[model samples]
Structures are given as structure tokens and as C-alpha cells.
Target: MLSRMKGSKILITGASSGIGKAVAFELARRGVKLTLASRRLDSLRDVVEEIQSAFPEAPQPLIARCDVTRRKDVKRMVEECVRRFGGIDVLINNAGTGVYGNAEFTAIEDFRAVMEVNFFGAVRCMMEALPFLKQAEKGLVINITSVAAKHGVPYLGAYGASKAALAVFSQSFRSELKESGVSLMIVYPSYTQTDFFRNEKKVGGARRPRGPYASPQKVARAIVRAAESGKRNLVLSLEGKALTFSQGVFPRLVERAMDRIAYKLREKQEVFNE
Candidate 1:
């Protein structure tokens, strides 16, 4: 079923910046009522102002300070959405943190922290909003994950694991959501030109992959299209699509490539060893 954007009450996490912020703008432009949640209230205010400036006639966005890792915060945020918008028609789980380092050197605690936000954070939001979502004409849940969720990269294993966990969990939960009006969509975004790298925890000297990163604005547009078209899984970028195909067709070859990448990264990053 096609999801309606206009008039829908939407809640987007991590909307202070990056993909989440971009999505908020896109939704607002479509006349959807928005509740933008992030730890940075000031940044979210800026986003609201920008959106209002872009579309004066559109619905103004409501900003909430939310740290997805906390159960109480997530609950309060969702309730605020319902109180303000009546009910949530769409939930975009875009809040996430990253850990940049090799598996061996990356602290287990770092992995846990990422998982708390990237995985459990989404879970908390869904659990809280499912009831409200089910009441809507066609409720939508968009899980903004990553390409790392699809393939385990060298330095991104920790981050990947977090997204991968969310992706895997989404599969089962989606099935359970069958017969329910609510629908789930998982978005696997590739490297994007975002501050994620600079904001991420750097455990060791790992040279980041040289990549053609996708812009958050571009990704946001794709997500909006997918939402309207009711696409189940959205994989952005040709490289990600190719990797998905290659993994299935040539599993051994893919493993070999990853091995080579791991070697290169380890060798290249040694120069910056701390």
C-alpha cells in the first residue's frame, strides 16, 4: 500500500543534523506535521527555522530533546509526538553513533554504546509508537541503517554490527507486523558526506576509505520517494547494490576482497598509530 505523506504526523530521531535533519525538511515540504528529536535542541531549532524559511506555508516542526539510548527519554519523546500531532503516522529511526577502529582494538564498550543508539534506540521508539502507528490509516516505520549493515567493512565492523543487528531485527519484527496496518522499511545508506567520521570515536589509526560519499540531501530525497512507493528495503548507491549481488553470487570472492581491504587498512593506518 502507498503511504501518504501530507497531513501525516511524523517523528524523526536525530533530526538535529545529518540524514535525520534532511528527512525532516523533506517531510515538512510535503506538508507533514513533524516532531524532530535529538540531543541537540539548539541545532534542531535551527533546522525548524530553515524548514519554515524554505516553506512558509508548510506545517511548522516541533523540536524535542531526546537521547534515544534512554528508555525514559524515548517514551517521553513519543508521548510528546502523540500529544502534539494526535497520532504518529510515520516513525523515522535515524539516530545513530559510530565507532571507527579495528575489531580487536575497539573497546567492547564502544560497540555497546553504538548498539544502544543504532539498534536498541530504534527498538525503544518502535515499541512505544507501535500502538499509535497501528491506529493510523497506514503507519510507516523507516529504519535508517547503513551499507555496513549489509557488508562488514574493516574499521566499520563495530558500527556495522550495530546497524546489522537493527536490520536483522527489523526483518523479524516486520513479519510480525503482518496483518497490522503498520509497515516497515529499512534504508541502507552508503558512505555519505557527513560529520559522522569526525564525530565518531577513533580507537586506532585506521585510514578511512576513500569514497564517493552521497549527500544527506540526496539520500533524504530517495527515502521520501521510497516511502511513497512503499519499497521494502532501500539500498542507495551502485556500489552497495553491486556488493549485495556479488556477495550472493560470489561469496568466496567477496570474502577475499574484504580480506584484502582489511590488510590494506591495517598497513595504511599503521603510520598514524597512537
Candidate 2:
């Protein structure tokens, strides 16, 4: 069984900001030694500084500059973490991107970019971490996905598709590693309060701001909880759970309801089309 709480070595990608950064803090409080990886070294330094100040007695966090889309970078990053902390007990694949537009209007290059970062990136990280995970007496992998994996969202088809693939991949991975010491977890978060929209590329419509979004801190806490408990899958927020259940119980009905809602919401704004 995966041990609860801290004293384990944990690594998180996309650690520069938002959910990844919040998770770093959450794990810090639990006393886990962390290796934070992202493309931005400056942002990573800031997070390290904050955590160092908060937990002066704990080991200083190891910071790595990595773009998970690159397999070589991910391999090196995992190797470095293993070298520093001995071996990884938890690996959180949280880096992803969103692309918005109709399928016809969406650029093929943009959709590919989303898949590379959101899907293949997680795949590479998982592969790179596998050996270290296997070496550990207990290991966990958490992939941060979205509710779009279950219900299609307007103009978020590419983003949703990427997450859907990750969810499926995680399910297969979980079963494949059933007898192994490593645990696999995939998380589906509903809209969350992050810079996701600002960072995303908007195409074929005006970006419609959304409300009732979950907080990054809340999502981060869920991730840490899943990692500690060795949960197989987690859907964050009541809204996400309800929507997923609707999809399961009444697939066509839920799809039609979502289609109607999207049309009504975006009709006047020209913000999206299914």
C-alpha cells in the first residue's frame, strides 16, 4: 500500500503556476521532498523561495527546467530527481494546453500542438518515471485531466479530446500495472480558476469567460490526497461528478442538453459553435 502523508519524494510538472504551484505548497506542508519541473526556471525559483521560507527545516526543493513535450527533457528531469531525492515516490503529470475552435476552422497544427503537450507529454513523463517508480516500494502517478473528457464542451473539442485520450490511457495503464507497486491516478477537474484561458489560444470565436470554476488550491489538494491514498481516479467538484453521472445514465439526453445550453449561451456572443 502507498504510504500516507509525507517523507516521500514527489515530482510535479507544470509547477511554475496555478494547480502545480498550489500542490507544491500542499505537499510541503505534508513534509514531502519535492522536485518541481516546468519550462520557466524563474517561476520555479519563486515557488522554491516561498516554500523554503515556509518550511526552513525541510530539504530545499530541486528545480528543473523542462518542457514535458520533449521526451529527452522528461527523461533527464526524472533522472535528476532520482539522483537528488534517491527515487520518486510520486509523479504528477499536470502539464497541458487548451485549443478552442470548430473542427473545420481549427488549425491542424494547433490541435496537434494541444495533443503533443496534453497527451504525449504525459505519456513521455510517465514512461520516464516508470523505472524510478518501479524501484520504489510504493509509487503513484497522477495525470491532471478535465471534465471535458466526459462531456463535450463547445470550442474545446481539441482540448477535450486530448484529455479524453489521457483518461483512456490512464485506465489502461492502471490495469496493466495492477500487480506492480506503482499506482496510477487520473483526475478530471471541471472549470478551474487558473490562467488556463489566458494561456490558451482562442480561435473562431470570442472567448467566453466562465464562472463557478473550482479553485486551483482545491484541485491541488485533491491531487495530493489521491497521490497519498493511491486513488485510481478522481473527478474534482460536484459539478464534474454530476455531469459525468448524467453522461453515464442518459448519454444522448445529456449530450443534447449540453448542446442546447451551449447554443443558447453562445448564440448572441458568437463565442462558440458545436
Candidate 3:
């Protein structure tokens, strides 16, 4: 159901900053009622203020402190969204954390933590929001997965695995909900200009991926477009598309290329330290 976003009620996680914050602003400009959730209430307030300043005509967004890793918090967040805005027309599962360093060096606990937030976190939100979504005339669930999910990368092995798991689940869930009024959309955004790198949990010092970073605003716009167009999947960059395609066709070759790139990144980090 390709409809305008003007009055849709949407709930977005990880809205404190980065892509989530950008998405909030973009949707606000479109006149959507929003519920922004994150663990950081102060940051969420700042985002709300920014949106009010920019899109004064838009409805004031509701904010809640939600740690997606916790089921109670997720439930409360969903309850609050429905309480404030009637029912959720769209749910954007964007809250995620990353872990850096080779899997060998990463602790099991750290890896599990990554999965809890990146994979299970989305699962919790989806499960909790399904009822409200199904009640809406045209409901959409957008899972913000990464390009790393396509092929496990070097330093981000845990992060990649977590996102890959979420991607697979989204695919299956889409089929299960096909008869229902809810639609599922998966977004694959490559390295984007955001504070995600700075906030990443690291087992060792790893350099962030360099260059060709898409702006958060650009990615947010693409997401809004996908929601309106009812696209099942949206890969936001040419590089991301190429990487995904090459990995599918020549898996071993792409693996070797990624290894070389990882080596260079590690070597650069070493040089900087020296």
C-alpha cells in the first residue's frame, strides 16, 4: 500500500543520534507522528528539540528510555508508543551496537552482548509491536541491517554475524506475516558518516573503514522512500551493492580481498601507534 507518510504513527529505536536521529528529522518533516526510543533520554530530548525547531508544524514526538536488550524496556516502549499515538503504523528497528577486533580476540561475553542488542533486540521489538502493526490499515516494519551482514568482515566479525542473523530472521518473518497486513523491509546501509565507530565496543584498536561513507541524512531519506514505495529491500550505496553481488558470485575471491583490506587497516593502526 504505497501511501503518503503525512499522518503515519512511527516508532524508531536508537533515535538519540546518528541514523535514528536523522530518520526522526526526515519523518518529522513529512508530518509523521513519532515516538523516539533509546537508552539516552537526554539525547532523545535534544533530538526532539531539534525536530520542533525544524518542523514546528509536525506533531511533537514522544520519547522514552529503552534498552532494546531488555524485554521489559522494549515492552514499555511499545506500550508508551501506542498510548501516546494510538497505534504504530511503522516500526523501525534501528537500535544496534558493534564490536570490533577479530573473533579470536573477542570475548564470548562481548560477542553475546552484540547479538543481544543487534539481533535479539530487534526480535523483541518486532514481537511486541506486531499486534499494533497488524491493527493498522497499512503497517510496515523496517529492519536496519548492515552490508556487513552479506559477508562477515574482519574486525567486525561479531557485528556481522549478529546482523546476518537479523537479516535471515527478517526474510522468514516477512513470509510468515505475508497474509497479515504488516509488510517487512530490510535496509542494507554500508559505512555511513556517524558516531557508530566512536561508540563501538572494541577488543583491540581497529581503524574504522575509510571513505565512501554515505551521509546519515541520505540514508534516512532512502528509508522514508522505501516505506512509501513498499520496497522489500534497499541497499543504499553502489559500493555496498557491488560487494554484496561479488560476495554471492565469487565468495572466496571477495573473502581474500576483504582479508587484504583488513590487513592494511591493522597495519595502519600499528604504524600510528609506533
Candidate 4:
């Protein structure tokens, strides 16, 4: 798998930080040529420099400042990647944003904004990269969704909805690409320890749920492994898998548990603020 990964041309969105940055480094170490895209050029450059420094022998990664919400930006990013790498063997749609609040408290605009980034962003990237992906020997598209999508967690309703939409789209598109030889992989990770919470657009006074969080590096490794093995889907962490399974087996029970946890966290946040 490592041998196959070496020299593969890959493109990653949200490459400025968190899981995307970790994945960039992981792939660079394996000698994959990369095109890293994000909204912040400065941070993206920092990531590129770090990768180049660590893997001096690896191909110098291409960087593009792309806001996935914009169709033009998405198109240009894909074009730049294709121009530099010849073709993209793997497209990782990892760019996403979140909004935190209860359903009644979160504004509709906040929901839209989250969907624009989390769901539509991945959609745009997938559509733009489909052509290049089709031309590859073993094309792969990996969408970084969340376990929240599978079980609509309280206080994260809007974010969960956006990811759920993306997850469903990934499933349907995977079937559509069945004959095209372009594989689509959906990744579900739970409570990853990243700046995701800090960067979230907070609509109401909801707090992040407390839990044993997975590292960005661990999630990135799972993503790369799934891509290399042509795995169709991956739900990272044992707790994530359990949550997904429990949701299926006992929906109401899981929902109630999530609500209680959210209540406790929100109370804790209120106390901290006080």
C-alpha cells in the first residue's frame, strides 16, 4: 500500500490545519505528490514548508488558497492541481465548518452557512474533480464526515444535519461512480481533538460535548489506510463505531443520552462563563 501511495498525486482541501494538515504530512512522508488547498494561504504555506522540511526528498507540495463555498475557487483549485500534478489520483474533501446550538436557538442562516461549507463544499470539489479522478488508474474520493451525521447529537443539530446530507450524498455518489472506476470513501470520526470547536460559528450558548477525543493524526491515518485499501467506508475510533451501532439498535436511547450529555455540557459552560 505504501509503495502504491508513493508517487501518487493527491489533493486535499482544508489543508491548513487539523486532520487535513496531518494527512498532508502523513502522505508526504510516504512520498506522495500533493496539492494542498485552503482558505488561508499563510497557514497553507506554513504546512507546505513543514512538509518540505520533514520530507526533503518528497515532491514539493503545491498550495492554493481556496474557499470551498465558492464554485469558481473550487474550479480553479482543481485546475491548478491538475496543471501541476498532471492528474489527481485522490481527492480528499476535508474542508468543513460547523455551527453549534440547539435547533430552536440556532438561526436558519447559521444552518445555511454550515451546509454551504460542510455539504456543498464537498459536493463542489467532488464534481470538479470527477473528470480528473476518472482518468486516474485507481481514482479515490474521500469525504470526511462525522459520526454526528449518523446520530444527530444534541447541541450540534445544524452541524449534524450538514454532515448527514454529505454522508447521504457520498453514499449515492459512490454507487454512481461504481462503473466509472472512481471510488468514493466516506469517513466518520467522532470528537476529534482539533480546533474545529474553537473555530465553529457559535449561534447559541452551547458548549462542546466532553469526551475522549481522537487525535487528528489518528483520524488522518485511518483515512489514508482506507484510501490505500480501496475501503468503501471508515468510522474511526471504537467509541465512534459504538455510537453508530447503538444509534441503529436503540435510536431513542442514544438520542436521550446525547441530550443529557449536551445539557450537562451547556450547564458547565454557563458556570464557566459566570
Best by TM-score: 1
In candidate 1, stretches whose alpha carbon ends up further than 4 angstroms from where it belongs are: 1-3, 270-274
User: What is the alpha-carbon lDDT for the whole of candidate 2?
Assistant: 0.85
Weakest 10 consecutive residues of candidate 1 by summed lDDT: 265-274
Write one digit per residue (lDDT tens) for candidate 3, span 1-274.
3346578999999999999999999899888899999999999999999999998999999999999999999999999999988999999999988988766777899999999999999999999999999999988999999998988877778999999999999999999999998999999998889999889876766556566788999999898888788899988799889998899899999989987977797777731221
lDDT of 1 by residue, 198-230 (tens): 788877655577669899999999999999998
Cα error of candidate 4 at position 269, Å: 6.0
Question: How high a TM-score does candidate 2 get?
Answer: 0.95
Write down the TM-score of every candidate: 0.96, 0.95, 0.95, 0.94
Each candidate structure's count of clashing pairs: 0, 0, 0, 0
Model 2 vs truth, CA RMSD: 1.8
Candidate 3: segments with Cα more than 4 A from true spot: 1-5, 269-274
**Residue pairs with backbone atoms closer than 3 Å in model 2 (clashes):** none
lDDT per residue (tens digit) for residues 158-219 in model 2: 99999999999999998998788788888998888888888888887656556788899888
What is residue 137's positional error in candidate 1, in angstroms? 0.8
